[model samples]
Every structure is written in structure tokens, then in C-alpha cells.
Target: MEYCSLIQLKTTMMNNFLTLFIAAFVFISCAKEKDPIIGNPGLAAQGEWSIPLNRILDGGPGKDGIPALDEPIFVSPQEATYLDDDELVIGHSSAQESKAYSHLVMNWHEIANDWFGQEPVAVIYCPLTGTATGWHRKLNNQVTTFGVSGLLYNANVIPYDRNTDSNWSQLTLECVNGELIGTRPEMVNLLETSWSTWKTFFPDTEVLSTETGFDRSYGVYPYGSYRTSEGLIFQVKDSDDRLHPKERVHSIISGDYVKAYRFSNFPETAAGIILDNVEGQNVVVIGSQTQNFIVSFFEKQINDEVLTFSLPSDDLYTNGNFTSSVILTDQFGNNWNAFGYAVTGPNEGDQLTPTMGIMGYWFPWTSFYTTVDIYGEQ
Candidate 1:
């Protein structure tokens, strides 16, 4: 009896120790920033998300509509020019003539500065580890330097400098993950200098294919030290300010975190979904014609049961297309939902007529449920 008691006591102590260790790991590492609104990549039934036929966000150094800047990075087109628009200039990097999509420099820069605004982010996307990282790159006429800001996901920021390089003679990075990879000027020559050229930088990275509806695993940020893969690692407007999936140049426009979509004019086949107990849900609330859809959650799936609700079309949209305010909540009690309308179908004499349609602008057709915190995760 004495020996059995001793064994039991040891087992109990061991179990307690393990429980404490696990608790500490979760407490120390599983820290999530308190974000109210989460982006859900609403996946459709066909296992495809709807990708706009046209690319909404424009890139490159020089372009119309956008104002010019002091940066030297420019498109390699016959008439290379300075970039004016912030969005178009977001990804512009002075890489080797071969590697137009060289992100190694950009990732180093972005990783240094957690925030990416109008300035350029030197990017490096490694598909093997699914790591998409960047750096804030700056170059003068003769010299160049790379800054490293260790701001990672779900952790306190770490500021560190890796190296200082002045002679950036040939801008290209070498990638070898159990194999070999490098971008040569010849590869750039073969590409038509389109976005595909940029994608070549991440041969193994996953990007949202124009042909596919599925969004690349763009927002997946892991804890500790891990590499990023090639995904939608490019710069984009803040979630609130992002353009509709279909609006090409307009979607990439940078500025205020504007509310661009509503739910009033949701298609007849569309269904409204409500998530209960959403702790950290950043979902892109999409109303589509079929039940097929995908929404990414901080957790593989939301813990709470989802409820479906319907608001009359008449109350939602003046025409036939509309977006509802996104709702994020911690519990079912406080639901934050808003709405935006799309100018797709014919709504004769509607104020949001095609003639008045601005690609990325949102006009209020129906009042949002402001009573709830749209940014709060339920």
C-alpha cells in the first residue's frame, strides 16, 4: 500500500507539472493582439473563392492617376518613369534586370518595419516554410542599406539591424531550399513584365491565381522563428479600406481605412451568416449565390455555432447588389454588422447609377447596425 501510494503521488505530481508547463506555453506564446475585426477568406462551395476578372490593384513605379514620388524604382518598360501613386509604387524594387519580382530585398525591409505604407518593402517569399517577409528598403544614387525590424506576429516587437550594404551592384537573391533557385535577367526578358514576372520571385510561394477563386494563404503568420512562403505578401489597403474583389486599380488604392462594402443589395441567392462567440474572427463577410464559401479564422474554425439570418432585400439594397457592414463580436450579445452596396444590376434612377459609379467608393444605401462593435471579435 505504501509503494502504491508513492507511485500515485509521483504520477499526480508529474501530471501537474505537465499541466503547468502547457499553461505557461499557452500564456507566454499564444498571445493574440486584441483585434475586433478579423478577415475571413470566405471560401465558396466549389472550393473556390470568387476572384475578380480584372486586377483591382495597380503596381509599378510610374503610373497615371497616382502622383509621382522621389523614388528611383520604375517599370522596365521602354519608357521607365517615376511612380506617382502610392499603391502602384508599393511593390516597386530596384532588382536586377532579370529578377523584376525579387522580394528578398523587400522582405528584409518589411520584417524590419512591421508597418508598410507608401514606402517600398523589400520582400522575400520562401514557399517551403510559407514565409512572406519584407524590409523597408532605401537607396540613394550610389549606396543602399537594409534595415531589419523584428516585428513578428503575436509577439512584442524586436528592433534589430542585420547588415549595411552600399554596393548594390546587381540586385538579385539566391534561394536554395534543398534545391537551387535564382532569378536571372534572362528570366525577366522572357516574362512580358506583367505581375507574373513578379511572381517568379516565389516559385514555390502560393499566390491567388487569377483563374482560381481561392485566396492564397497570405495572412498566415506563425509564432517564434519561422519563414514565410509566397502568398499575397504584397502591400494592400487596410482591410476596411480594401477595394471590392472585382475592382482592379481601385482595390489597391491606399488611404483611410474606409468602409467600402454593404449588405443591402446582396444577391437573392445570398445568405447572411452570424457567428456566435467569435473571439478573434477577421472574416470577409461575403453573400454569394451558393452555399460554397471559405472564411479563415484565427483558429482552424470558429468555436461557436453559426446562425443564418435574412434581411429583406428591399431594406438592404436600393438596387440588387449591396454589402453589409462586417460584424465582429466576442459574444452573441454585441454584434457589429455594416452594409455596402455594389453597382452591378439595373436599378433605374437609383442614385448609385452606373454613370455615377466610382470603382472603390461606398455610398450608404442602408443604415449599419452601429449599435454593435463591428471591429470587436465575438
Candidate 2:
């Protein structure tokens, strides 16, 4: 890997055109009620970092610069007036409950230590890379909350476990520094979709409220034009410019192999399914641009038998009652929801295992996977 001194790295970042512009916007928009940053170099000490140490630069809030919410409050869908139908949100559903966390709230706070009924989860998100993943907060017997380290590697957030101060790369999905280095966090299923789409899937779903302890502009996007523009605030190790840098794609990864499925690649604007293999693991990806969501699941029956899936019918859409939650039906006559929950037929109440995946911008995936394949790319 290319290497440089820490000072030289910071200087190089400051010299970048986007950095200089974004640096000012971040300090003002992202920093907490206190000072701008605290300069926690704990993860940078002792040559302990997995990635190049020089690449770990101070993101203006220092440690806990952008504070992570622990057990944040939630409101009913009717109470969340801040949300609009078209606004995007990170959503997850399980046997017990379904929840939606707005990007309006997430853009300010990158992590949320939340409870899904009896289960504890951390919503790890990076607004810069536009990626969100659900991580199980418990490692072994100890339950730990994750906090923002106020550091950026490849322009993505590096979250540290509060229990051990071990740094984890959100995009890498692995511990890169501290006591737990090289460890991978256990992930849960999550999808990014428009608020209207998710609400339709689970109308009774609770919405993450703005009642977070910190005071900030929960409605405003702190990073201006970052999502739409091709420019990056920090440089990344990217080579393939096959798609626009800011274009979002849903990806499934098994070991080192990664395959991306784009919204544009879907055969129709309504929900559809794609069955393919990644690193020898069979996966089924479902998505819809018009509905505005993307998700994936491992193709297998509860008894460990392989299964294939296809849309149930076209009449569901023609009737204008297409909720998209139950988009596919397996050959075993079992109907599945977008979260892969078997809702009908023989396997009723069973759930198809979700693949190791997340929705993210095109550039960050290419940076880490290096040789990612785009599904249906011509």
C-alpha cells in the first residue's frame, strides 16, 4: 500500500478542492454543541491500524464529533410530520417489529444504538458514502454501544466500540484498529427506500423520532451537494468509474467477492427479482426504482434446501394494491416479503436468510472490493 507521514496526509487532504470547501461546511454543520473537535489519536497510536495509518485523518468532530444516539426515542408514523412521502429512510423489519429511521436524522448523527423490541442494534451509516448497515451490538457476551471516532478513512466513517475503543470501518464491515482489530461485526438486514414505500410495507412501523438528546438541524442535510455531485470530500482508492460516483447500488458480498445491482438494471419500475450467485452462494436481489427500494436475500429453504423465487403475479400491480412487501413467491408455494419473511404456504412464518449486503454509493464499494462486478452491466 502507498504510505505517507500523518502530517503530509492531512496537508494533502487540505489541498484537495472539495476538502477545503467541505471542511468549512462540516465544522459548522456537523460539530456538536461543544468545541469543533477533540483530536482523539487513540486508534492511530502504536502502528496498530489495519489500513494505512496515514489515511486515518481527523474528521472535524474528533471523537464523538458527530454523536451517536443510544436507545433513541421513536414516534408513530402519524406523529412523524417531518417526513415526506419521497424522502429516503433506512428501514428494517423482523418478526417482532418494523422500524424506519429517517435520513434527515441520520445525516446529522451517523450511528444509532437502538432497540428493536428485545434485540439491540446499531444503525451504522455514512452520509458521505451513502451506506447504512445494521450491526448487532453484542460481541460475545458483552453488549457494546458504538460511537463515532470522528475519523475518516477513504472518506467513510470509522466507528469505535465504546467497550474497547476498537475502530471499525463501516464500509469494510470489519474492525480495523484497537483491541478487536480484524474482527467482523455481525450484521442484520437493512434497506434504504423512500418513506412512502416503507410505510406501505409496514404502516404500523415506528419512526425514529427527532427527540434525540443532541440539538442539531435534523431536517437539513449537513453536507451540501455531496450526494448529487460527483465530487468527494476525501480521496478514495477508486479505479473503476463505470458509473457515476454518486450513483447508488445494492450489493451482496460473500467472502471477497462482491456484485452490485443498480436501480436502472431492474427489468421494470415495479419490484422484480434477480437470482444469481456470488462467491458460490446463491442470492436473490429485489428492487424497484419507482417504489424506491433495494434489498437481497440468500436463496434457501428453512430445511437447508435450495430454492428459486419469482414474482407472484402481475395482477397485484394492475389492481393498484402492490405493497411490494410481498413481492416474490418461491417454488415451494411460499410467499416472501421484501425482508425475506415467508408469509404464506407451507413455510409460513419462516424467513429466508438475508445476504451480507447494504445499499451504498458506487465509489466506496469499488474502493474496498477492488474487483466488484456489476450485475447486468453491458
Candidate 3:
């Protein structure tokens, strides 16, 4: 290399320094763009965070990375052969229609934006937490869609609404962060049971089809062994050992009170019915071991008559179909189905108001409601 004058050398050194500085600046900018935290600025600013923001890990998928089903397709139950007989499903019904969303499909996409009758709804399922529930998607009569926020609270999914960008805790059933903090979405009753049981209940129901616009192996479980494993993937601050951490339970929340009933607590052979006082409200829980189904409804009084229920005996007339009907007899010998509808008896055509409840794993229920009361306990 030729030697240069002092002034010329100084100028050359300055140029090299500027080049290095520009390269460093570009490198830092690109690095931040790749950061999950920096990529989600709206989520970063979410207020009233229940857990430490740093604890919310990138669940391998970014926001909307696991796409939500917006315009879901459906087919008759006969066409849903991909689902195993014992595989779980979320079932919902309105006055006009009944639908089933198989766990096989929900295992990949946790949220499905659909409608029940004329009312918009979001069917949400968290495989990690073993929770499946439905929420009214309309806020102040305006429709909103939800997506996976790539965040977890107590190992449960946190869904964010596309309209307000508000992050909601699936277990808590309320907006925990962003613009709609503390807002609770109206809940619709959803039944979680085996595919076989659901089909038995609603043979003519429509099933969510795998034609979800996204390319995902709907037959394969995305979380792998996590579903069967007892250990949690993320940290949860609270727990209760009354039931197995992964044991499934049917939970009901009313006002500030919550209660959970495990499958083990139900009678093994026949149908069992229990009336419990929850938050001063009389709630009736009905379970069928043979059917593998449990549901709760508020005790209703018609014409100042309080209805108490019991499992219908074998002799009761069940529309000539005892195997398929979940018949319950009141003190007056009126027959009712699991849905609290008086099908045949003196009270025929009457309806028992259904209470909004959920079926989920024990750990997540306890993690969200630490003080939840367990049925049959003091």
C-alpha cells in the first residue's frame, strides 16, 4: 500500500469508521425486527397484566401464527370420520341449530369465529389447559374476531380481539389487558364430551370441517405429548392438589363464587343428580357415567313450585328410546332431558334455564380461581 499524507490518512480512517457505524446500525435494526417482543408492540403495551410480561414466552407461533377459523366450514356428522370415537369435541346448540367442533380440528386452531343462529360467537379451546368454551363475539352489538395472542397466563391461552386488540384470559373469561381491561364477554354454554357421546346426543348435528383455508394436519395433535403429560409446559402460580393436575373437571362460575366437580366424583353405573347451593343459588348438576356427560342448570320455580330432580327409573316411558335419552324425573314424575327440557310429563314443553359453565382440566380452573369450592367438600 502507498503511504499517504497525514490529512489524507485521517480522512480515510474517518470513512472506514462511518462504514462500520452504518453496518452496526443496520444490524441492530434487523435484530430488533426479529425479536418477538419488539414485533408485538400493541401486546407490549397491554395494561393490567396478571403475570410478568417477560414470562409470556413466544409459544413457537407468533401472533395469528396459528390462524383462527373465520368463515368456518361445516359438514354433516357422518362426514367427520377423521375424528376418533373417543376423541373430545365441543358441542353447542341454539334454538335453530346444533354444531360440533372436533378436538382434532381445534387442536391446531384454538379459536373459531362462527355464528350460533343469528348471534356471532367465538368458539375457543385451549388444549394445553384442557378448556373449551364459547363467547359472544359482539361487543355493544358490534362483531369482533379473536386470535391467538401467542401469550399464556398460568399455561392457559390468552386470546386478543382484532377489533380492540384487547388480550383476554381464556380461563378468566375477561379482558385482562389493553383497551377493554376488566370487560367480561357474554358466555354461551358449551358442552365438552367425547365424539361418540356427542354424536349420540345430536346425530343430526353439523360438524366443523377440515377445509379451514389453512394448511394444517388436522388429524395430528400440534402439542404432541403435552396433552397426555402431567407436567405443565409453563409456570402457574397457584394449584390445588384435591384433584390431579391434569384431571378433567366440570366447573361453574356465578358471581364471585366458583365450584368444580371431577369425573371421579360421579357415580359409575347410573345417572347421578346433585343440587348444590352456589353463591346462594340452587344449581343442579346431572351426570351420566354411561354417556360420559355432565351438565348444570339453574333450579327453576314455575308457579311457586320448586323442582327437585332424580334419575329416571327404568320403567319410565322415554319416548321408546331409553338408551339415547338422558331422562330425569322431578318430584312430581315429570321427565326432563339433560338439556333441562321437559320432554314428556305433566310439565311437558317447559324449559329449565341453563347456567353458563365450562369443562376443563383441574389445574387451570384452580389456577384461575384459587378459592374455587370443590363439590362434596366442607
Candidate 4:
């Protein structure tokens, strides 16, 4: 029965490879919106692009001719009467027309550098964990910050721009006034761990830790895609050591629907497969029809690591159909197994409808275990 599925899967795979590629091309080029600001052309949506905080502080001389520097200014409660409640304001910069997030901006020092570009990224900052930052779409190479689930606990700063709100809307620090507030030191430390791994993405940028008792740090650089090109930036950080293991794990393409589990059965340490902790891992997913799927992994290093699997073309196909049952195992014998199929051309009665399958899972971890399952058939 497994061999039969392999035969049918192969037949379907070879016949459909060309059709699959052409269909994927048409769908990606013509179907999606591609930009988030098209429908809602607001300030933050239009004027504000995402950026790292370090770049905002020392991102070279802005149009206003001010060198980016870490200048945390304090204001007396008396000198300026509190007009807006539940908000902290940083001194206004005379250079740009708008004021950036002060508490959020002053929150951290710099991100750690590891792989060239493999950090978890997001656009919001969490005041509790102090790990919210964004890079401009134009400048970020369509990349993003990671480790947001851990940082969401302390999200207090809300950025509003003309696109989303009034252009001059006061940037405010709003929180549930009486809720439990965590320490800045711990949050700063977490931010350092997150960003330190991502410093490779920004070659020119330098990570600087806090001099004061606060755990805040800054990335110093002059020419970032954010400062001159867009306007502002927020630094992204690294993941926690516990949730993210020192070793990286990945999946196989035909291994789709095949879930990975840790052999250790450690409380929160289950991943696809474990490799050498000292060396990183490299894993790729290849589909029956080329270009039908993509494989990527996060929370693990994707450096020059060895992969020990191969898909034998002949073993996967029979009678114009390719069918196979593949099993992947950890060194300890725990395994994730699944079935796959392929074809050389469309079957006589099979309709050539293109399937748009965006295959990726979001595991929102917050010092806890969470899973985001995607249900689809295409």
C-alpha cells in the first residue's frame, strides 16, 4: 500500500511539475496585495516605516543635521503640567516633524550579532520585556524582528502616525496603571540576547550596552535603511536560551505533515530533530513538484550545517506516479513519518487548477509552549 501511494504520488508529481511552477508564478505575481498600506494609507502606515532603536539614536546625521546619540532627557513633573495622563514624553527633536517613542526608544542598548540575518522580528515594542522594534520595509530587505511573543507582556508604547491617526498625535505610554510592572533590567537583558544574534544583518551597526544601572543598549551606525531613507527604527533582539536550544533543527520537504518531536521528552524542549549543540544545522524541504513548497525554520541557527537525507527519484516513482512513505528519526529512535506523491504530467481527467498554499507555522512562545497550526488542502 505504501509503495502504491509512492507510485501514484510520483506519477502525479512528474506530470504536474511544470504546471505547478507556472501556476505558482501567476498566483504570486497577480493575486496578492503585497503592500499593507494600500487600503489604510495612514501616518504609520505611510509615513512611519519600521526601524531599530539604535539606528534612530545614532543612525548618522538626520536631515536635521543631528548625529544620532543616546540622550535620555528627564523632565520635571512640575515644569510641564501633565495634559495627557498615563504617558511619558521624551524631549521633542526639532529636526523631524514627529516625535519617536521615547520610553520604547530608551528601552534597550543594542542587538547581538550572530548569523547574517536570522533574528525574529516585529513592529511593536513591549515595555515589560523591552523587546519591541521594527525595520523599514524599504530598508529591511523584506525582513522582520523575532521573539515578540516573549516581549508582548510589557507592551506599553503605542506609535501613531498620520496614516493610522493624526500626524501630530502625541506618542503615549499607556498601561493598565495598576497592573504588575516588571523590572527593566530583566527586560533589557532579554533584548540583548535577542538582538545580539542579529547584529550580522547590519554590518555597519555596533551594539553598545548600557553604562547606567538600566539594562538599555544601543546599536551605533550612520547609514541604515531607516534613518535617512525612511525616518525611524527599533532594534530587534535575540531569543531566550531556554526556549531556543543552542542547536538548530529543520524539516524535509516531502516531510510535510510529518511533525518533529524531541527524543528527550524534556518538558519544553521538543523540536523536529536535534543536532550537535556546538555546530548549527541546515535543513531544506523539496516538494514533489518543484516550487510547490518552501521550507524554513526559526528560533534555531541556519548556518553551514550538514543534512543527511536524499530523495531517490527512482525509489519515489512507479507507473507515471510517485508514491512513498518517508520516516525521519532523532538519534534516540523517536520518529516523524509521512506519505508523499508525485507525477510527470496531469492525469487525463485532472483539472489544472493552481493551488496557492502558504505553508508555515507560527509558534508564539512566551516563556511558555504554544502552537499555531495551519489547516489547508491544496
lDDT of each: 0.25, 0.82, 0.78, 0.24
lDDT of 1: 0.25
lDDT of 1 by residue, 1-378 (tens): 999999999999999999999996575443323322222222122132122212112222212111111132323432222211111111222211122322222222222122124444343332211223233443232122223222111111112222321111011221111111221111101111123323322222222111122232312322222232211222222222222322211111112121222233234555444222222333333332232211112111223544232333543332432232222222222222221221222321111101111111121101111221122222
- Badly placed stretches (over 4 Å) of model 2 are 1-47, 302-306, 313-316, 319-321
Ranking by TM-score: 2, 3, 1, 4
The model with the greatest TM-score is: 2
For candidate 3, list the clashing residue pairs, or say none: none
Once fitted onto the true fold, the runs of candidate 3 whose alpha carbons sit more than 4 angstroms away are 1-44, 47-55, 313-322, 332-334, 344-349
Per-residue error (Å), model 1, residue 124: 5.6
> Which tens-of-lDDT digit does each residue in 1-378 have in candidate 2?
245687788778778967778887786555423333333456455448888765666787788978899868899999999999999999888778899999999999999998877777899889988999999899867989999988888778999999988889988889998788899988878878899988888888999999998899887889999989977777666546888988999888766668998988775545667888888777888878788777888768556767877777564454433554787787788888878888778989988788888888888877687569999763
TM-score per candidate, in order? 0.23, 0.86, 0.82, 0.21
Q: Write the per-residue lDDT of candidate 3 for residues 1-378, one digit (tens) a residue.
A: 355687789999999999999997786666445532222334465566654565465565878987889999999877887888888889886446779999889888999999999889999998888888899999866899999988777778889999988888887788888878888999878888788878776677899999988888887887778766766666566667777777777888876567988666676766667788888888998876566777899988866889877777766434332344445788876787656677778878787887767888888765566468889886
The candidate that achieves the highest lDDT relative to the unseen native structure:
2
RMSD of each: 21.7, 9.6, 10.8, 27.4
lDDT of 2: 0.82
Q: What does the lDDT read for residue 177 in candidate 1?
A: 12
